[model samples]
Target: MKVLIVGGAARLGPHVIRALEGEHTLRVTDIVPVETQHEFQQVDIASPAEVHGAAEGIDAIVNCSVEREGRRRAAFDVNSRGCYNMMRAAVSHGISRVINTGPHFTIQGNTYTTFDYEINPDVPPHPSTNPYALSKGVGQEICKVFTENHDVHVLTYLFYEFRDHNNPTLRGDHPFAISWRDAAEAIRLGLEVDLATLPSRCEAFNIHADLPHQRFSNEKNKRLLGFTPQDRLEAMWQRR
Candidate 1:
């Protein structure tokens, strides 16, 4: 299958590119050009022309771009509007599936002062607290709109506690810490699943690896995509 990864030159995007490149035809794109071994394209996802151009003949798209600011304007443009542009392009070109990333901060209303709240994929999303979370919330809404209006299969994953490969300090002890490899696999799993059989109109899952204090239940992912992480941070630390 052919896949277009937006912001593919970014840190986590590179990891996802590597994981998918071996098995699928990959077209990597970013707002700015970067050196990479994969097929690269330069396109601003915020522009409909660029998105439509880049999405031509692609099978799927992974919405990985995030523009974070203290306010909602820029973030909304990139996260929400940018995602709409990509979905429009994908549908126009006959793409079948789209996988989008939503941030854990969307659950801020559930755990404002503490990080101890348990999460489940089926739980209703609470109110967003900040601009970043608001953008993600809007993005998820856009995904649903595409699915309902366009008849496109869209899956969203609430990515939590993203691990920074180059910076150990950025790694958290939270139970939602998904390994880079596992996160990539989750995308692959979501991409392969048949959406027509799903019982719901829209599907969202919490992307997390096994943690002793896991706040979110991954049962939905398992039931829908048979997705389960192959590695855990505790096991990696034990090896060290």
Candidate 2:
């Protein structure tokens, strides 16, 4: 299986790259030059031509792209339009699967509310004032729309922050975090899962190492996608 990773030079790129290495054939693209040795394409995903050109012949694509916070126009272009262009290229090329990184803050309000129930993927994303979150939410929606119109299987992973490699403890201040290794594994599963077996062609998942607060449920990651993080933040912290 050949895979293309957009924004593959970003902070989380190397981790995803490491997880899929030797498991599949790989290609990488980003606005700037990708640092690692695998075949690299300097691409601006918001540009349809560049995305289509980069996507040619790829079986799968994992979008690790995100614009820096507070840059409103850049964020919309990269986060929203970028997803649109990728799906356009994907559906055109007959690609089977696409994985997008949607921000966990898409439903920013859910995190602060005192709801007795845990937040799950089924919870609608509450409108957010934060530019970054709003843009990413739009991106996820675009993925869903494309999936509805095309034969592709789209999976969006709402991520919070990457945790420390050696110490993946749940800090009291932070309710969500995923170790780099776990984050990578999740993408691997997202790419391999068969859409025919799923209830829908499009789905979004919350990605994080298990937290004791139970603020978010990752049951879908385990049951639907076959991903179960090895490190539980609470368990790792208790040993210390």
Instruction: Give candidate 1 regions above 4 Å deviation.
Output: 111-118, 164-171, 235-240
Best by TM-score: 2
Clashes of each: 2, 0
Candidate 2 ranges beyond 4 A from true positions: 107-116, 168-173, 235-240
**Candidate 2: C-alpha lDDT:** 0.83
lDDT of 1: 0.77
lDDT of 1 by residue, 119-187 (tens): 676556663677788777877777787888776887777776666444444434666677787888898
- The 10-residue segment of model 1 with minimum total lDDT is 163-172
Top lDDT model? 2
Steric clash pairs (candidate 1): 119-215, 119-216
